[model samples]
Target chain A: MQIDHSENIVELKNISFAYGGKNVLEDITFNVHKGDYLGIVGPNGGGKTTLLKIIIGLLTPSHGTVHLFGQDICCFNKWSKIGYVPQKATNFDNSFPLTVEEVVTMGRYGKPKNDKIVLQSLKQVEMLEFRNKLIGDLSGGQQQRVFIAKALAGEPEIIFLDEPTVGVDLKTQEQFYRILKDLNKKLKLTLVLISHDIDVIASETTEIACVNKKLIYDNNPENFLRSEKLKKLYGSGVKFVFHTH
Target chain B: MEAVLSLFFIHTNMFDIFQYGFILRGLEAGLIIAVIAPLIGIFLVLRRYSLIADTLSHVSLAGIALGLLLKINPIITALIASISSSIFIEKLRINKKVYGESALSIFLSGSLAIAIVLIGIAKGFNINLFNYLFGSIVTVKQIDVYLIGILGMVVIGLIIFFYKELVYVTFDEESAKVSGINTNFINTLLIVLAALTVSLAIPIVGILLVSALIVLPVVTALQFKKSFKQTILIAEVISIVSVFLGIFVSYYLNLATGGTIVLIALGIFFLSLFF
Candidate 1:
């Protein structure tokens, strides 16, 4: 596949990061274009989420430069343009007395609450009926949908999700991916997803970036599956059935 | 007929107690503190930072002791000490220099130590110190009432201004930051408001029981599992009721104001648990 540097929305050049003496990511270069669905796959500690955090400016790399929307990350203040759904979205104190609508309204923090936008976001996730319900009362799958709605409430052009489907049921996971694909195709929203389900993510995303403490593979999913890079990251005997649909 | 008459008579006496200037001043301050404490309390309780109130209260005690030693207005000194310490605690928590609970415990005991030393230097506890320690309603001066009123409005106004951001940060801080909210500024603002609320509350709830005023009503309101706004409103109602009833009952029965208020709040909590 041919690459177009002029249309790049995110550019990371020679990024290296370490925690104390341990190097988590080293000399990584990647770019995400507008409206691209990029999947980042790696082992549990392979720095997939760390890379995502770095792109979002949550963590600074020890070496390298990150440019978001053609501007240096340090000078990039248009955070509303990029939405984020962190890992384990359910890890918050569920019993916190917040309604689903209240949680969604948080997407527009530092601004006046807008019921129309909140309702619209909820409608996108089909969670409008549960707006008045307590956040903790919903099932795990339902909660994940609400979080997606929350990210959507900001009307972001790009969204970065880290392990978003963890602990959800299989059917819900398929539905979740469908919703994401719909958003990407219909709204032309850029998505950066981190996942462990190699087969589904392989078939779902437009491009794949495999990491094992480094950028082991970066290209179209067809080449990723046809190539021998999966074994290099997941090791020998790692079996995966590439779903046609 | 006799029970009905006695009930009416007691209600009349309750209203009549407001005639005294000190009682009026105390009630005004107590009402304002009632509103301010739980407004901040709901956020603190939701964020699992309820201990911040207790830690700041202890620091306020040291400030009060310092004021007593120097013969200055204790409320002003307590205000300075608590606001400063609250900022320090927030920074320590943010910088990861100390575990949050460890920091709270350290400040709690360290400030108490300083307060004890100051009390000793001032020749030990006196009538004034006792009033400050346990809360004497009649001792609430007119100037304290004015100060409380001004600070109470400031706290309430800030909460109103930062309502959405505060709720967002309390619910999920990282996401709030991701969405362009300056979470550190919001957090610091909250702790500073908490400091002001605690210092103002000291004159009514006293050092030892001030946390109850800040925590109990909110916890009790949490029992209903209402929405965030509803929970805060319920907490305000519960706090106002407790403060008013406690002040009135203590006046008639000659009881400690802080203890009486806390007991009423505890009673509400237990009742909610039962329901």
Candidate 2:
């Protein structure tokens, strides 16, 4: 609950939450500054999703007040400044009959911006051609791209993506991250990504925070491996595999 | 002779229609039901809360039985009983104990049972019971028009203004809750709208027929559009077309109005399966 709130975009101070007599998150404290790319990783039943919910203002902490951009998270009226790409599983409904353009257009809700953000969002993810096709007919890669496009439609300052690469093949996963990196660099968009993949996240994210019911490790990825503290966080017999081409 | 006379019903000629006050009343009632039925139906289909609709309709049937037993305007009593049933269902169908459908089913079966008992309580079943049970196009009234129009506009207005929130919530309720949208109020608002539509349409398309009328249009459109906006647009179109065509066909062929419309809708739904 001792988050530094001086000039950060998101500051969580001593936040704790429990549901139905079971504690999911304990007195966790952290601040995400503007333009910071924070990646979250942890084992199952970890509070990674729970923490993301708190950031998105979905679940209020049992004991702490969240501050966003120098004000309370509850006070932030403008949602366009915070673009979100919920999990791929959450966005796609197989039985739904929707075209990619129609799904993408929903990104325009609640805020007014130029069509550039929409098209650019789609273009960045290489989904511009499939815009006319039904989302139900799309391949996994194209579907993922459409969701990312929709998320970026608002052109927010910070983008929150939860488990963006759950079931896709390794190549598409790599492609997705590469596209995200390009957008982050060219558009200068702050990214907050959550993934269960240890190796990929370790390489791609500028900052890493290992979470399991608490903010166990929050530091730069370069130092993440060397720290005995972080090594302990990942548990025993941890090994990283590297492929040489 | 019945076919020829029934086709005469479709003439709907204002002058000749009112010269025969029965036809005039029938037209008024049909139009009123047409407008309100779809107005209430959209949310029920969207929330996938069809059981409540089914339950309410059955409960409304019991109210109609009371009217038959006492020899009063069954429609008023039907509306009252349906609304009351909906209220009771809403109270117990909270986030605790069992699923929402279970609660709806309990009331649904109870109401249907009560209606059956009432039928037994009276003498030979009134012909009116069949009209309310299935469908009847010969019963529209002028007062029903004003009521349907006013309530229909209010419900549609609320939907349009809050369209985005509704879509967002329907897509993923948890996310909507996190975004600070009031899921509870919106849910109740949707149900209230559904109840109003049920009452409005029950007079023409009886409880069973109206249920199909409400859900069929929405379900059929879902086959063609995944986007909430487009689906709703398609649903309204299908509903209007089926109503108009069913009315015309039923009038000309001496058929049940509700059944004909639902058949037309089912035809469209089957056609979409091929598409």
Candidate 3:
């Protein structure tokens, strides 16, 4: 599962963002090396989602530069190489009429339609059996997996997921992380996952980047747990809940 | 045996109705709109922007007034007005300051006021305006049929061409944008197509009830909960049947054409609830 760290997949330099004249992210700098499983952990209103949006060109930074796959993001048009799974709460209308297979097929938009790719993507997440089922009929965890299959259908080299496990049950969350880890190791796909669950992210991700309107820490997850920065960032109220499994 | 014979004459009389040129043209236009309305409606309803159809239909009223004032074809003027106002409404919504509903409300009331003022200035066109407001399908001219056919094809063609993009954008705008789809352009294109639909439908469905034709069938189809393609097909069927029934019933009963069509659609919607 080892991947070369010689090349950076995403490079953010002095990224700063503001909303209504108030700063949300200030002078943030980081790099996501190739095939790296980067987890971004921050408290509510800490600009985690905004940071992700800037990297994916959903929101332009007030002042900074972003490079994706070595190309400046402003000129970057190869979006097929990047996949995004947004927060499930805001992803779709519950009343929308679309099958699981149809939702995944949207990933192949602008390209020739390929049923094999859609099926393969669904099988990757073990959701092939539900391809014909309505997307709205699925449970929260099942919906998340279908979204993952959607991202995979694009054959993306890197995928950014925002709060993907929110509202998912604990058992399903564990299974979801396992599936994500398997995707990273087996497929060598780069991942940038945002979560508030510190313990699970620290256990699962190869690298951890802490943000509190600043890049407080960006290094190995193990080192992050051992450092005093986690306590300083979240105050003394944060408690570590270890999971046996 | 007598009942069977009477039913045969009734069926023959129904076909014989088309021998009248105006009736034929009215049905022709209604059927075209029946296909076009739900094609645009499915996307609009999914995004909860169904009110935009209402807003644009009212805006077309102002366009019609201007057309009457200038002594030009109101459909052409209404098309210009609705399309331009659609762009304006979309721009206002995208600015993020004005809420989507607020933008629609502003256009709805603002356009209605303008239409009333123009109607007052254009005096002596009350009869024409009444026809436009309530829809006089029997008065649908040959030129209107030609215009509806050509422009209706354009709208349907564009919707089909961007079918995948439209579905993706309507389902999740953010993801579609991340995946390299130009969501803003697709959104504007959708409303403009809606404007085209609303304007073209004016001669048959009238201004006030145009949104019903666009919205009712889709809402009824949504009850089926089928896949996207199947749902659109169901909506089309509902729309076509409603239009056919409305025309036939109104022709015999001497009812308002627009009200008749919408009532039929509403009846179908209520009937779909039981299924």
Candidate 4:
């Protein structure tokens, strides 16, 4: 599961992000290489989502530079290569009148001739059968799948998901992670996932980046489990139980 | 049975009405508004800015009053006023201190106050003011028809060209911005278009009922479980049918044109809820 450093797709150099005068992320650094499943776990209000937003270019870091594909993140214009599934995707208005296929097609907006890609992306998420169904009619887990398909329709090399399992049932969450594993292993797509469930994502992701307003741990999941980082991030009341499938 | 039959035969009566030049011009303007209003309405309803349409309509009424006092084209004056006020409202919405609904309420009340004061200063309400307030299909002029036609073409063209972008922005604005769509420009353009639609629709539906023409059809369409494109198509169909039938009924029954049209759209909405 080790990713070569020379082939890093995302590199952050002393990334520090703040909202107004309040510091959200301070003096953080990390690298995501091709085909790396990097999981970001943090406590509530610990700046996890802000860090993801900074990396995805939704928010600018106040003090540091980001390099995507070895280019300055600000100037990197090939946004089609990086797909984003925002946290709010799960809470979209159920009355919205969009079909699954149309939602997927939104990912292909700036691209040319995406009919085949749209179907392929839907199939990847196993949602091809429900492509014509209204998005509001689908269950929350199914809607999340459609959102992932929307990101995939652009045929992106890297995908970033922000707390995607919120409000989803336990079984569906397991299935969702299985699909992410398949996307990483079969499609060779790099993934950056943010989750509050430290133990669950630690088991699934190859690398774990534990943060509490700063980069605490940036290593493989095994080392993350053995280290004192989890204890530092969350106090003695927090328990870590690793389950193998 | 006879009433139903006469209602059916009202199609011929509609033809007789259309034979007059002024009635024909009114029909032209009414049909164009039927299309443009619902197109703008879909976005407003989706974005939770349906009330903004109502506020802008009242603003257009003040514009019309100013034009009458100045002896100029009311539609042109209304267009200028609506666009200017819409930009101002957008700026207010962007300011962190002012909530969006608060901004809309301020404009809505402020514009109505302006209209009332102007009407009082200009020697009180006249038949012309009544016509502008409740709408008079028989009074539609050739110049109003031309203005509606040009504005209709521009609104329809913009909606068609930016169909996907508009849908994306409407469904999820934050995601659209991350995807590199100029969300601020699209949002401002949508507000401006809504303003243009309100001003142009005033003559056909009146300032009091213009938002109904823009909103009711979309609400009716929402009663069914359909796709976004389907919702828009159904909304347009409902609007067109209501405009034609409402105009015909008003002509034969001697009812107020704007009120009758809005009543028909409301009737259709109730029917949609039932079936």
Candidate 5:
């Protein structure tokens, strides 16, 4: 048998993580393919963020082998190929004296400075007009857009967002998801979004991974909504209203 | 007004101050610090490590006191003490056993206590201690000038080489780490550079007030709406002007040079609030 390595951008095998001797993730295994929008959903403290951290190499898994872009993660040095927006983007210090353009330019580090690419990223997020404005002066939703623009500035093949809409209003969140969906479809960019909203995960993502200290379900989002795994993960009286848009 | 300005400029007394070698040396040292202090301070303030500046300066004071008691070069000793303390602070921060500010306060008080005890043992408040405490740039030797110049160059050179990395880490450590930046190395290097800056500054800025040089100009610039790069440029300008004018005024008024410079910076900071 032959394997087509180009299909998969990320591969994980028997990954587990423990904090202070308590297990947060257990023997998790999954693969993210090129251009796939993967949504990871789980309960609070269920290790969704930790799993994303492990994938991004922010946290080292206690046990397992991981590969990115067909190379072992330990030896992978091409980090510009992927972008990460951490969970604290919404809570970044408001007084930080950085303009939007400067913040976005950080994403292009180790690469030659390119004003055009920076402008393109800002334009993609509809924040081009505010490029010269200080990040502290922006609203929460606007700041979120700027952070996404920062991640996009690098032109990465994959972008990982950990609760990108945590502090965003519901109306803005819908718009935010629309922009993400557009990026995935138009740019063919791979996305790995860790979110707690089950409905959003089921409706927006192409694939869903229900994680609760273990891999509960990993399949198409539609099947995930129809399955009983979500109820099992959340316990009795759990309700999920799936929306198709 | 123009005639009065011309008469003041032509007065021989005004030009005589710039002719003295000690005054010239003091100006040189002050100018170098004016450039490097706030350059490092912007990152320090942004990362919320401004208190570390104060802590390291106190540690350098203890080292200076010890060096004086042992008949050694105080600046070298101060550098050693500050670098070691910076390393320890980084260790404490990573350990997560103590709060960051608590770690800083511990070092701050510990070093200050050591300095006071040593000062008492060395026969209480000597001229040498006073000079170090309030800064006597008039006593700045040629060797001190060379050392400060070299150290300032190293700090500026390192910052230029690691500008992007430093900015990335300061803005967002977790994201920078994920982006393949060696965040631990950068963090340690930043603390080390900050320690070096404090040590280099002590001879001219004094132990009690070195952080003012490192922090005040940046804060003043923060009052303006500007890009990070622009803020740094404005901060450099503010620092340079304040240092030169402070030294000039201190010479005429016979005030402590360090305190004068810091007061000028404070004045600028307050003025910026209204803008």
Candidate 6:
């Protein structure tokens, strides 16, 4: 990993949050550097999404400080600089009536219409051909790509994707990852993905962390599976089944 | 020919209510609805809060009942109470421990109870029922015109200034907030706009047709367009034409004004559905 003494892309410290009087995240601390593909994995309700929200300045933790681009999040004014592809969050209405081009163009909401940005982002995800197709008419995977294109409209340096592959076919998931990999390599954009698929994370991400309430950073997946910490996380019966080197 | 001619030369020669003032007032109110309804409708429809639109209008029924029971302006009371109810919905949405639909249903039924109670106690409602259930163009005075005009400007101004935020929050709220779109403020502002638009429109289209005005045009517009600007613009144009044509036809045919407008809008929406 190239360690540049430059800006910390995302930083959260001692973050604490709760929903329904139950602790969702307690003492969550992590830092994501520029060009880091940090994949977060944890069981259901383990605060993976909550952590992403904190980093993106979406939800304010009960107690914590979040810094984006090395500035205090509360005071940071550069919002258009971040691209976020929230979980497909859209239902298949079949009649939604919006074309892929229009959906992708939504990413440039606050910025000047950058055709180049739109085209490049689509090409990065290899969805340029379907830019004119209606979103409701696309397959689950293709629709996900349009959404990814929408998030990339502003050409943000850091991208946060919260479960981008949720509820899609396995082939589509692989295709989505291929697009993501191309973008990460070509643009050098810092990618933070929240996922439960450890296999995908193992193959794709340079930095992988196991998060549940608190975050342990730089814990090599190899080292993690060997240790007893993961068994406790996934329960005694569940063990990490490694799929790749 | 006579109507259009009379519109241009009415005040100088004619002295009847049909002169320009009545038609102008109706046209003005319709114009305001044309602008406000589609935007609010987009949010309401996206959030599956179309029922809230129904609930709000029903609640506005009680509000209008309060105004009528007190022998005052119903639109104003509706504006007040409907906005309050919308805010209440937002507050409940955040509580997270409670169900949102339950909040909407409780408020809806509670407002219905108030409306029924008020009607029972108000001594037969005095034939002014159409003003609440089916709006009249005649009830729109000069003051109502100015009120609609001003609120229309404020709603449009706020929407124009916050277009991106509104769109972001509407489609993907979590991403919107993550990208720093101030979802709370935007959500409240949207509900407030929805309440205000519904309240103001209730006076012209009545509660039943008001949600139609807010939704159908946008639904029609969505059939072809994708960008918010294009979608809203087409819906506005359709609304303007529908309102204008509906008023002329209603006035000439002696039919109900609000019903005529909504029916015409429905016709346009149906036309958009064909190949």
Separate DockQ for every predicted complex? 0.76, 0.36, 0.79, 0.69, 0.79, 0.43
Q: Give the Cα error of residue A69 in candidate 1, in Å.
A: 1.1
Q: What lDDT is reached at residue B157 by model 4?
A: 100
Candidate 1 per-residue C-alpha lDDT over A1-245 given as tens digits, one digit per residue, 9 for 90 to 100 = 34343488889999999998999999999899987899998889889999998998888999999999988998888888888888968988868899999888887654566889989999998899999999999988899999999899888879999999999999999999999999988888889999977877788899889877888656688677667877877788877777677
lDDT of 4 by residue, A1-245 (tens): 55454599998989897787899888998889898899998889999999988887888899998998888977878888888898989677787888899999999878996689999999988999999898988998999999999999988889999999899999999989999999998888899999998777778898888888888756678677667867877666777787766
What TM-scores result for chain A when each predicted structure is judged separately against the true chain A?
0.94, 0.89, 0.95, 0.94, 0.95, 0.92
The DockQ-derived docking category for candidate 6 is acceptable
Work out the iRMS of candidate 6. Answer: 3.1
- Which sections of candidate 2 miss by over 4 Å? A1-6, A74-76, A88-92, A242-245, B1-43, B63-94, B113-125, B175-180, B225-230
Q: What is the C-alpha lDDT of each candidate?
A: 0.89, 0.73, 0.90, 0.88, 0.89, 0.80
Q: For model 5, how does the per-residue alpha-carbon lDDT over B1-275 read when each residue is reduced to its tens digit?
A: 36633544665477788889999999999999899999999999998899999999999999999989988889889999999999999988988879999999999999999998998898875687788887779658888899999999999999999999998899899999888999989999999999999988887878889999999999999888788898999999999988988887778767889999999899999999999
Q: TM-score (0 to 1) of chain B, per candidate?
A: 0.95, 0.84, 0.95, 0.96, 0.95, 0.90
Which window of 10 residues has the lowest lDDT sum in candidate 4 chain B?
B5-14
- Model 4 stretches with alpha carbons more than 4 Å out: A1-5, B1-14
Candidate No. with top TM-score: 3
TM-score of each: 0.95, 0.86, 0.96, 0.96, 0.95, 0.86
DockQ of model 2 vs. true complex: 0.36
The alpha-carbon lDDT assigned to residue B220 of candidate 5 equals 93
Per-residue lDDT of candidate 2, residues B213-270 (tens digit): 8888888888885565567778778877777777666665668888888898888889
Counting clashing residue pairs in each candidate, in order, gives 0, 7, 0, 0, 0, 0
What TM-score describes the B chain of model 3? Answer: 0.95
| CAPRI-style docking class of model 4 based on DockQ | medium
Per lDDT, the best of the predicted structures is: 3
Cα displacement (Å) at residue B229, model 3:
0.8
* Candidate with maximal DockQ: 3
Give the least accurate 10-residue stretch of model 6 chain A, judged by summed lDDT. Answer: A88-97
